[model samples]
Target: MGSASLWARTRGPSQKAHTAEITSGGIWTVAPQLEQERAVTGGGYSTPVGVTRAEPEVNVPHPQVDAVARRAQERVADAIEQLKDYLAIPAISCEAEHADDVRCLATKVRDDLSAMGLQHARVLELDDALPIVAADWLGAGRDKPTVLIYGHLDLQPVAGEEWSTPPHEATVVGQRLYARGSADDMGGWVSHMVSLGAWLAETGTLPCNVRLVIEGEEEIGSPNLERFMDAYPEAFEADAMVLTDCENPSDAVPGLTVSLRGLLEVELHVRALSSDVHSGLWGGMVPDVSTSLILLLARLLDDDGRLAVGRVEVDEARRAAGADVPLTPEIIREGAHLLEGVEPLPLRGTSAAEWMWWQPAISVVATTLPTPAIKKNALRQEASATLSVRLAPDQTAEEMMAVLRSVLLTDPPGGVQVELRADGWAGEGWLYTPKGPAFEAADRAYVRAWGRPLVQVGVGGSIPFVALFGRRFGDLPLILNGVMDPLTTAHGPNESMHLGIFGKAVLANVYLLDELGALGRDGIRS
Candidate 1:
């Protein structure tokens, strides 16, 4: 499907007109036709920010940014093409068979980075882990800040997902480039690559020292990122870091990620009988494990389908920040691809940002419950469901598990052998408070590039690598930004990155380098 399908208009009490733009903080206005033309052209270029935006929201233009922006614009097509080359490999990290593909992509990136005049561009290997690609250029000298850029090359598994376009072919429909890794990551770092490439090509050097670290297994929750970090500490040394795996609030408004929810998976197993029992014969006499399982799961949720137990109260400051996020029901409906007549769970006096980014949520990801293929009028011996929990920011696995166990283990419907076990991957959440000259530098850079200062935002999903970065280098400024919008559909089928976002992101990176470099190491360090 194309933009026509992705942005299909819906008229109802829950959704607004599809043609709307969120220009002000937390406010939306009906968009004119001119706003639609502020998108990508066939050549993968964007309408100049000056022309599309009518007037600048923040004008902090610098002499260096002007030249860098031009060079970056000239190479937007190359960046798009480079992203396609990388996305085609299908370097899925979760499957055993695709291990070689991950290695191949890592090597290709290493060589390509080497070609960009970076020093020591090579693939890093660990005994039992996938590879990571690294390179750096520090010739800008010690006085300038060293900026480390992070992104992942691995992709979510697409074997069972339906796609409108070929998942790996990198198709461009409407204004987006549709591919598995287009926005989630490849586009993120590729924009940096193009920015760095332009700096090297136009002036023969970057404004600041730069290091590139591309992980090969992020989609698998970055299980070995800490191991890679431990084994190669020097590769991570930087005065500041630009974590490129994040989202913009809107394609029109850039977002600086300030928080991320954690992930924890738990499995619930119910067993009442050793063998299958005919449901009709034992309908009322026996306590069916399947029915018991359904009831227990229901107990964990509220009428709106949110996790009822262990909900956290938000402070006024955070609650106000959440209110400033333009997460109207229309945006949520379009972004989530909800079917007609199906509405998002009621907000229930909470802002979407607060509910999604700060509070806890749960979903049943997998279960041993029978399907039609195994249909029989009988109760199976046991049933299990693997629940994926999105924990509150700053919450730990142990804390959420304790709360879950307290509710799930007490008062069984049939007194069946109920077992609640922590299962699958688990990671802690991160909450950061950005302050310093570095954030000021970032705001200047974004203002020049996007005509507006960066808006603070939080992600609902867990990024293990991000928490690792926060834990390891909390003292340094961590500027998280990327080329994703609500419609990116990352980790899901039909994933795409808006080409306009890609183009603007490259310029933002260009300005970011100049602004950070001007701050000098000493100024940034404090």
Candidate 2:
């Protein structure tokens, strides 16, 4: 039954590959239809519906773990209410106008932590940046491994017109709770909090010591996190870190994001004249800044829709790693929730999964120009745009920036003045082999909670702090786990959390903490 469901989910009616053939480069080149079958029954692949090529060798199930998970499940209503209260704060960290709101949200988090029995909870202020909430429960003693729990208190701005319900007002429709930050991290935060609260209520002690660091600026590329980490390194010290800020591939599947693409945001400005000129007077004589900027931006992507500038070529090993866990086109299409009649980018010989997770891509995110609402007959003197580049795991920000500069600035159209500036933040991508006691515990916990093996996946989005945490904590095992599903629509209209999965996620975290505590009891260090 599981195999049939896996195949059905992966194989659509139209996509059919020619044959199942392996190339000399170790990349699997199969027709789309055949690829779907291979993905379902092939070795090394696991699906959400308990379908697997190999039996998952998990740790012995903790006897009391089920009871703890059930307790967490029983508190779903309390968790939802707490998450609703959290989502009520319009903590838009990217906008400076919401500075006080963000601070207030941080304060609430600190107070909640204190209420949850962490007596040392306090707000840490760093220079002019927003405050961060930090607290620790060290009651489990030094023999147990200390685990750091990281989450964000900030959120993306909501588009009022696009939302069906008020963005700050949590409303339940079916099993989903509609609100801003309901899924893209406030839900995750509440999940951890509820799990901890349940454990404290039932046992009065955690299996491992816990340290919590909830930041207020994760949405803005975590601009102040590195400085905060540098100043207070000891506060974040732990054997393992659980970053509850990533999304699962689908609602049913539990995922561990093993890799994340880095980000480099650039602003390109072009000037052909000193000031706006009348188009009627200089229509033929003067070069249009908008035209020049468009041409310059067009050079960034080739006909294949791949990055022409700063392209990072994936080697054989990387290709093998990506291909080992292939994402079928059907899965990609469903996960993306693409608009009707829209298709994925036309990158030949590359699957949708590879293009998204393993390959580097560039996008023109925003353009600063005169809008149609404010139309003018005069030719603008300058045209500017914001470009975002998603770098692969093997690529470095410095090297890619140099390549981009070389391509964008080498030759100017009509000798127009072109200036490309690095827009303040550049985060390096992170990739780590999933191993160690923490990973094993996570595998067992996920299986126990979800009734399936955990799927290892890669996210194209950049979480700047994940890489920073690795650098600060000296390569501790970091688990990128969360409750958001593909339909959560985080950072978009009608953002929500699937309340059913949200409850399951709390249970999973409960099991995870229990499993980690077991490792501590055995004195096994990752």
Candidate 3:
């Protein structure tokens, strides 16, 4: 699909257009084009603070990263060469045709991780389910905390006809890389591998006792993760988990995601008659089930777009913890481009910051119905709808689902057979009270790496695993960080990351290890 008209105009300048001289490791001269644009627009640029100048002594500037970048640069040809081979083997977990391919991908990933210095890296085979790849590096003693990292290797189902480029081909044009899994996760996974390689190559040991777990069922709602977690509780027990799944709020504001909205998804199916009656024959006499279902679904939210369900409410106490910071109206307005010409949703008559951080919203994500053209002159027998209830930290998934089902079932429009099938995944929201050593170390590292202090924000999306990890290791100081920009189109087509932002991410991760050590040595251990 073509980009939005506004996005086409605001695609922004290329790196060369933004900077004149690109330095290797540290400081580099700003491009004249970018300087002029900044001067005219009065928008400041953020560069990694002290690293503008090169530091040549200690590390090799991570040759692995260079090699990876070179490989990425040749993505077009590589994608072409690998296209048929990849697409021919469907890896859809839901389908039997692709099961073997899924297993193969798991093995390939484990082998890659193993080559990246984790000699013992291997995949954990879950019976009757996709496998999860795990690796461990115990560089530190038990006195030091272990950092568990999580990611996934699965891709959503891709029908053959829906593309201009090959589905499995890691195609690159100019600077944009295109592929089925390139952006959703595969690219991100590759980045972690490269980063790990860089750290191992330079330090010969990880900064902490680390465990890496990458599952293949994330896109499938992680059907087996919790079961696996239950079977082996100690496998992922760690001080922190670095989830690379999320995105940074904006390129300028490198943020630490403070919270993720809980998810409550359900499909409400309404069935009227078993057989189709011609709409022409039954025009005025019969009640259209699709119409009734639509009307009922419309009442789910108030005029303000907030969920009218009783369970979806803000937690004042938790809200006060992060409270709304300085997110501006202009930022929210610009971000609502997802709605195109439609006006932005009224978020409880509050500032974008407050609404995003403290409010719950209900979205009718999808409703399935036969084509109007295919409609017989029949009273529609059934129509099914899906709703995504994004809950605030105060709400529970069970409570939200209960409220939703009750509201729909309470008053049905007469003869329609409304069967609300509350089926979908529910992951709880999290609000961590940042304190003690890990937070302090992370804060210091972020501040030192970038000139600005870390901005904590709540994301509209959920990881589903963070809450699980939190429950597994109560009171563990979990830190979250990432480099994907807010408008990076992560799950959507044309997903890309800012190179400069990624470089800063690497520097941040590198310093984070040292900061953690400092925190431990200075008596912050609990």
The candidate that achieves the highest lDDT relative to the unseen native structure: 1
- For residues 452-486, what per-residue lDDT tens digits would candidate 1 score against the true structure? 56667889999988988998998899999999889
lDDT, candidate 3, residue 295? Answer: 79
Instruction: List model 2 lDDT by residue over 1-526, tens digit each.
Output: 0011111111113322123222212233333543344433333443422223354444444455445555666676776887888888999998889999999988988998899787589999988888889998889988878888999989899745488999999999877899989988888878898888878877788878898899999998788888888888877888888999887766666778877898888889999888999999998788898999988888888886667766556655445545545455555565567777867677476545567776788888999778989888998999999988898876887887788788889888989999989877788898766666677677766654554457777788888888887777646778888878767888888888877667668767887887787787344453
Stretches > 4 Å off in candidate 2: 1-61, 159-161, 230-234, 315-338, 521-526
lDDT of 1: 0.81
User: Judged by lDDT relative to the true structure, which candidate is superior, 1 or 3?
Assistant: 1
Clashes of 1: 0
Q: In model 3, which regions exceed 4 Å deviation? A: 1-96, 160-167, 171-177, 187-189, 230-237, 271-282, 303-340, 353-358, 365-368, 414-417, 521-525
Q: What's the TM-score of every candidate structure?
A: 0.88, 0.83, 0.74
Q: Give the alpha carbon lDDT tens digit for every residue of 188-209 in model 3.
A: 4454555566567655765566
Candidate order (TM-score) = 1, 2, 3
Which pairs in model 1 have colliding backbones? none
Give the winner by TM-score.
1
